[model samples]
Target chain A: MEHAVETTLTVNGIEVTRRIEPRRNLVDFLREELGLTGSHVGCEHGVCGACTVRVDGEIVRGCLMLAVQANGCKVETIEGLSDSGELARLQKAFHDRNALQCGFCTPAMLMAARDLQLKNPKASREEIRTHLSGNYCRCTGYQAIVDAIEDVLHG
Target chain B: MKAPSFAYAKPRSLEEAFDLLERPGAKILAGGQSLVPSLNMRLSSPELLVDITGISSLAGIQVGRTFRIGALVTHAQIERSAEIRKQVPLLAEAAAHIAHPAIRNRGTLGGSLALADPAAEYPACALALNATLVLLGRKGERRVPAGSFFKGLFETDLRTGELLAAVEFPRVERSAFLELARRQGDYAIIGLAGVADGSGRRIAFLGAGATPVLAKGASAASSLEQALKALGNDIDPPADLYHSSATKLHLAKVLLSRAWNTLSKPH
Candidate 1:
């Protein structure tokens, strides 16, 4: 039996194909095979949200989805989203607001907050908090993270 | 942690999926939110995974007198679905409390029920609505009430080769889902979903027992204290690390009182 599964998908606007083990998670695929290591893997069980990325425009846990499942799917990670200038406004706002500390959770936090921005432009503080509750930020305590997204929303 | 090696299969039709499931150590991979995590931790080591996403029949939402939610419907879909928000807001409200948005985007309704984690919100909501679960097997279709569906921890009435087709929920005159967790996205330590319609009122509790506790007519116990006191008989909760049996009971009563008090008020 062929242990490796062949998958073709668009990653950050680039179409790529690879043979990977059926169990290789999307995050590991991005990191090991593609060398796009922006997404962090924390609490691989899905609690920490450090591995959040966009699959077909919706944020999902990269560690929770296998690479073989990415066939024909469009994925947007921190590298691609950043390269595309999609996060310029949120990034600058995060920078100005000092929304990050230690920088471990920044990529995932920005990805998650940006998802809320695209979906709900005029979200309230509570809504932003609820949306961001998935991305764990131990350093900034989320005050700055929420403020960063709110800045992009209002500014 | 890396997942143990496993072969993968994509079944284009339910028939093909059923045949693949007949394999001794094969599992159905729906959203892979819970399963992937377990696989990574080596908690489960299935030899094969039959990915069901390609099965077109398993994905959709049909609204009628009762809503039919396809098994593959993601929690994020439920949270944002206009139909669910309009007809059965109970599901939408409960779906929002499940994990975070990233988790919701991939965690599916069928996967959640099939796994049947005691702390999950969907089971409680299903029980509160008196929803019927549709299961498909080689013999054909079978309908099981949500009350009797969950057998124990991570166990359901789903036979070895049966696939959960969809869940049917009746329209309710009023419904609400309330939960208490340490954080916004964490699983509820104690939660309650209460729904009422012409049929009657029912309250279901999560994190109360081996499965979601369906409290039939317990909300109509005259008073909140009376209802909670009566609920003790229905829920002999097993202790988990996060909450002891007494603590779970206490939280259940507090949440039930709060939910029942709201249900007590005329809608």
Candidate 2:
């Protein structure tokens, strides 16, 4: 077996320099190496959105990516969703509308939602559902999550 | 919870990336989503993992009479690309339906094509669009047509040390449709993407076979009924854990049916 190589990159607007195995998963790197555990690891096979995060302003599955691939790239985890310890509107909506249950998928979900809103600020309910259909929430049955996004969209 | 150790290489250039790729027991890390999981499962134990992310020149979208997309361009970039949206709407639609928002952000076009899952949308998009795949290695660069790209399940024409550089798709002013299952972030059990540009059409199916298979009959069909029937017959879907190839074949028919309807409609 080959050993992992060490490298550094930016995470959530902060430059994080660390030596890691070249093959270290972005999910593990974020959670274990960087200690940003907000990005959960669910299926690890990219089927579950629990490990979702943003790389260079785009939402992506952390588990599906390798840490080395993120070298010199800008990454945003659920931890970086807010500035100055304040939650973004989407976070508040998710909290207010009760969009989470186990909360394992919330970080990725919020990041994905944030990406969608960035692309289309006034996205319709159907558009949100269409864009967010990839992130799964087995606990909430998705109504509350959809409702949360709807509230934010309507507002 | 530790990954099996692997030697890592950060190639500074595309040539270096290709050189690293040519070595035995080497795997290229593009987006890393698919390759990392395979590594975690111990299904594929490559001794050396090439980090191509350092080669910044490989990431970008080039629009032209025939658009050339760098392999490193992420799915999110493609989905949000105004040029791709205007020129290759089917590709955009397919990219939009990929795993999830976060996955799209990191997953690269080249990486996904290299992974070559039967159910992935990019391969099917490539096939439907008749894209050209550009490969780099110690020798030089070569372009492979979409039809010849996939060799089998989880396989492609990629050599041990070769790197995929870019995918060139012919710009088509046509109507298209993409339809698939909602296993929600799971690989599609079935997917259909059809491109129709007045004179001829092309239909591609994913998750229905060992590789991305083109239903050329559907593309060759001059009428809607013929196109649907061609799609139904052309797809020899293989049975997997998700759905039997027979069931997927039936689903392929339905998906192509919808795609054909949308494409053949008077616009």
Candidate 3:
């Protein structure tokens, strides 16, 4: 069977179409095809949240969704979010709190944090911890990450 | 790691989907939360991926005599739905325990039930609530009770060329869902889903066996102490890497006691 399929979708605010392999995941499509490398790929089996991105206004594991499956969908990566200035406050807070150590989990952490901010701005400390539980940050022991999100939520 | 090469198709209707399923090595793709990971890990490789998310008929929540949830309903949708929170709150509570926000945002109820992971939250909830699954096929539709639907680990009665269209749940006012995991989003080491109705209590456990195990001995017991004792007869949970069989059974008792207290209380 032929593996490549024509897929068209909007990234950030631009619509792009490409003929890609059906097995290529959304993260790879964003990085290799569109030259958007903000979303990192780690533990490709979906255990790690490094490949987190927004699809149709909801955060999802990029590796868990195929590029062909995202046909006609709207995708937003960290670069798009950063350029939009929507993550300014959270990014500042993360910097202020030194939330990142190795910095590998920053993009996904910021995405998950922003999601919580939009959905529940008044989220408690426990809620912040729980919401970010999926995004693994082996550095700073997650204390500073939680502190950063809390600052954005209540600061 | 990346998924092996495969053809893909997104069918807009069940008829079209069934037609695609006729192809050799065709596999249904719902949320792909579990399937995609397996693909990436080389655990499963199919010739064609039949993306069923485009099918409109298989997505929604309907409330009548029984609460009906479409197979395409995502876990996040279930967690945030006011109707599900009101009618079948156990499912809503259970949904919150499934993975984390991102996984929940993409994982579907039908996908979870169809996978029948034994450690997943929906199967035990379905068993506890005595839910009925709606299976659609080329021939017609068939309704299977949750008790009979789950065959074993990562297995279900879902037949070849058939799709789990929806699930019908009879509303039970009193129910409790609890699980013990090392972390918030990790799979439960042991979990309990309990429901109390006029008939009596239906207690089901996840991560306790190859399939969701109904604690018949405990459900039939009249008191908490007796129920705790009877639980021993109901299940013999296999040990995982981190826990021993004895430890799992002990944790199962702890959850049962908590659920028993909650269900026994006057509503």
Candidate 4:
């Protein structure tokens, strides 16, 4: 079957139009089509938070959402967060706390942490643990990650 | 793995959407959290995907006689919905335990109810709350009570070409929810949703059997022990990698007792 849909989406405040395969997911489109690889694809089934990105105002797993579904929606990835100076404090906290080791999960971790910092600013350590539960770190850096997020929550 | 190639369409209106569903080998695509994964694994390869995101009319929260939630309302929306928190607190609590902050952001309420996963949170909560599912298809709109809607494991009363448009949760006086999972975001090994009225209580168990069902005669069990014993008789749990049927039934009783106490107590 051949399926192609022509649609335009505002990615990081830039409007781009493309005719792409219907099967292409948002993560693959961001990386392959737009060359925005900040969002990693860890679990294509949406278990891993590696492919997380803010759509409109909510974080969605990029691997599960098709690019076609993002048509006319605003997408904010880690690159956009950096460019827009949105992650300045969180980034510094991660670096200062050594929250990242291999850095494969850093971008998505930051994305997920940013959300926690805003929504549950007064969350306890356990709450922070639950918030970041979806994002996995092969390096087992839960303590540093939680500390970094806590630092920002209070910092 | 990437999903196999398939024809896709985004319908601007429900009429167009219903029309697309008539196409052979077409599947309705909602939040895509579940369907996309199945597609990527080639576990399901529909010839066409009828995307409903374009139908703006199919989203949002409406509070009237009952809590009418659009099928496209994401789990995150449910967690944050003040109306849901006030009216159906059990649903709000259940939504909080779905997957994670990100998955909850994209997983839809309608899709969860329609997929009818045995371990999912909504089915059990819906059963406990006596919620009604609104479906639309070529035959037009129909309302199926939650009790009869869920057929079996990962199955429902939803027919081919039928679209789960919304779910209506009846207003209840008191309710509480509980579940056991290996991890926070993992599927529950067993769960229960309990509701209380002036005299009696109703409890629904998830992952206790082929489907989320009432503890047989559990309504009459006035105490926790009775509720547990009633559940053992009601449910025939299936064994999986994580648990044996006996273990699941035992855990089901434990959780149901907790739910019973939680509901029986005053706030």
Candidate 5:
């Protein structure tokens, strides 16, 4: 079996190459190899959205995607979105609404919220709840998170 | 949890993919929404991971008299597609009931069908629509009717080295998809995907059995009351952790009633 596979992909805005085990998922690769720890690994499965990241302009569970599968793809983490100021308004809304508690699911929640904002800016409260359904925030009961996202969308 | 050690190969063509699949313990990797989770949980451990996403031919949607959706077409694509909404509205409706935006973004129709999860929407939708699955292998290509494609739980009739290429759904004028889940993105406890055409109605139920079951007895019934009564003869859904078998049957009847009403109404 081939233990190490060479993979090259653009993360955030920079291109990096590494020889990693095929079993290594995208989240672990980003956090361990590239030192981009903004994306959390809560479930290591696709259920929780804490490991959400944008690949080729679409948000996907980072833990479900292998690093080698992301080869030649443009990968964006929560760090990238924060650094690019793409999450500025959403961050502000979250700050104002106190959407986060313990800040475990905040990064992925923001990533998912920004996706909804870009795709459906005029999304209803129900739609917001539905869109963020995969992102489980045990704290805040999601009311404050929904309020924060609603503020960014329509407020 | 982490996936067990495995070799990965991204094949850009079907021939290369077939060659890789011929290797021992080779597993095809599609969207990996379900497979990756199983891999992390150590439920599935394949020695070789055959990454088939690089094959361009396996990803597209074509609509005409029949809607042909490639196996790799993601749920998000189906949900947002105007063409799908205007043509196969049932698919569009069912697509929204899938996990969520993130899972839909990565989960593919082929993966869902190939997995044959009784709680999934596509299998029931395919059975209701009488869709045809295009299977490609080393020798040639073959088409399997949706009725016989699903074998059992987490099982399909797809032969070894055969890949689900695309699904062809005949256009229908009236169709309805309804599911009752605990949460927005949770798997359906009981779901129905039904379509009415000139031949009659075809109703399929998910989470009713080991496979997506076509409710023949209820589908052939002329009236809603008869259909509701016939549902008992059609399915005997197994009990889950939360819901009783009797509760599931009741919920299935509820969905059938609503779908019957919707299909009976003129568009």
Candidate 6:
């Protein structure tokens, strides 16, 4: 079967057009087609949060979304969080607190935490724990991850 | 893993999506969090995927005396919905407990309901709240209550070419609560969610059966004691890898006890 849907999506403030398969995952389209490798594909089954990204102001697992589904939607990846050579404040907190070990889960963790904080600026430690429960970090640096979120939430 | 190659369509209207579904082997793409994984695993090999994201009519929260959630509403949409919180806090609470931020962000309420994972939260919420699922197909819309939604393990009564439009939850004077395994994003070993209308009660159990289990008869009990007793008689959880059917039933009983205790207590 073949589908030729010519559509344009404004991703991270950049408009791009593609005529592609509807079954193509958004993560693959981002990494393979658009060359946006910031969104890593881990546990494509949705267990790992490494594929996390923001779609139209919401954090979503890129691996699970179809590229065609994101038509006309705004997407923000880790690459979009920072402008030029500087890092976002949360990035600084993550580094200061040693939140990342393998660094594979950093982008997704950052994206999820960013959404969490945006929704609840004064989120408590338990709240952060409950919210971040969806993103799995195999390196077991959850304490540091929680600490990093705590720093941003409290300080 | 790359999903099997398939045709794609982004329908701008629900009518368009419905027309597209009329095509054979067409699958509706709501959030794609669940469906994509299934497709990649070769669990589903639909020839056409109708991306309903372009159908703006299928999104958003409709507030009223009761809450009606558009089928396309994401997990995040349910979690942050003020109308859901006010009308059915348990549904919001269950949405909050769904697999982490990323999964919730991409998972849709209708998709989850259609997927009908025995361990999924919305099923429990639906069972406990006695919610009605509104489905739209070539024949038009039909309503199925939560009790009849689950046919078996990972199965639903949804017919081919049918699109889930919304879920209507009847308002009730009650408090709600949920308890799941500590797997952290994984399906719970056992889950119990309930709604207590002061004296009467409604309890739904997950992880105890092939699908979300309900003890609706017990929900009408005049007291927690009666409800707890009736629940044991109503539920028949199946044995599986995580737990035996007996164990799950026992867990349901225990959780029902806990739910009753929580619901019967002061706010």
| Interface RMSD for all numbered candidates | 0.7, 2.5, 0.7, 0.8, 0.8, 1.5
What would the per-residue lDDT of candidate 5 be over residues A31-136, giving only the tens digit for each residue? 9989999999998878889999999999999999989889999999998899889999999999998888899999999999999999999999999999999999
TM-score of 6: 0.91
lDDT value for candidate 4? Answer: 0.87
> lDDT tens string, model 5, B154-200?
88999999999999999886899999999998999999999987888
lDDT of 6 by residue, B167-251 (tens): 9887754656566565667777678778866446677877767788777756666676787678777777777676877777677
**Candidate 1 on B1-267: residue-level lDDT in tens?**
999999999999988998999998999999998999999999999999999999989999998878999999999899989889888889999998988988889889999998999899999999888899999999999999998899988889998899998999987757879998988978888889998765557888888878998875476577777787788887877777778889988888888867775577664
Chain A TM-score from candidate 3: 0.97
For model 3, fnat equals 0.97
lDDT of candidate 3 at residue A123, scale 0 to 100: 100
> Model 2 Cα displacement at B242 (Å)?
4.6
Quote the lDDT for B236 in model 5.
96
Q: What DockQ does candidate 2 have relative to the true complex?
A: 0.57
Q: What local lDDT score does residue B208 receive in model 2, on the 0 to 100 scale?
A: 73
Docking class of 5: high
What are the per-residue Cα lDDT tens digits for candidate 3 across B40-124? 9999999999999999899999999999999999999999999889889999999999998999999999999999999999999
Which residue ranges in model 1 land beyond 4 Å of their true spot?
none
B20-126 in candidate 2: lDDT tens per residue? 77677787777776777777777778778787877877878877768999989988788888898888888788887777666676688999999898889899889
- Per-residue alpha-carbon lDDT of candidate 1 for residues A1-155, written as tens digits (9 for 90 to 100): 26898899999888999898998899999999999899998888888889999999999999999999999999999999999999999999989988888988999988988898889999999999988887877775699888888889987
Task: Report the lDDT tens digits of candidate 6 across residue range A56-97.
Answer: 887887878878777778987778876532237789999999
Which ranges in model 2 have alpha carbons more than 4 Å from their true place?
A1-4, A11-14, A82-88, B265-267
- Would you list the C-alpha lDDT of every candidate in the order shown? 0.89, 0.79, 0.94, 0.87, 0.93, 0.80
Worst 10 residues of 4 chain B by lDDT: B258-267
Which portions of model 3 miss their true places by more than 4 Å?
none
Q: Is candidate 1 or candidate 3 better by DockQ?
A: 3
How far does residue B100 in candidate 3 sit from its true spot (Å)? 0.8
Candidate order by DockQ, decreasing, is 3, 1, 4, 5, 6, 2
* Residue B24, candidate 6: alpha-carbon lDDT: 82
The weakest ten consecutive residues by lDDT in model 1 chain A span: A132-141
lDDT of 4 by residue, B91-121 (tens): 8999988999888888899989989898889
DockQ values per model? 0.90, 0.57, 0.92, 0.88, 0.86, 0.70
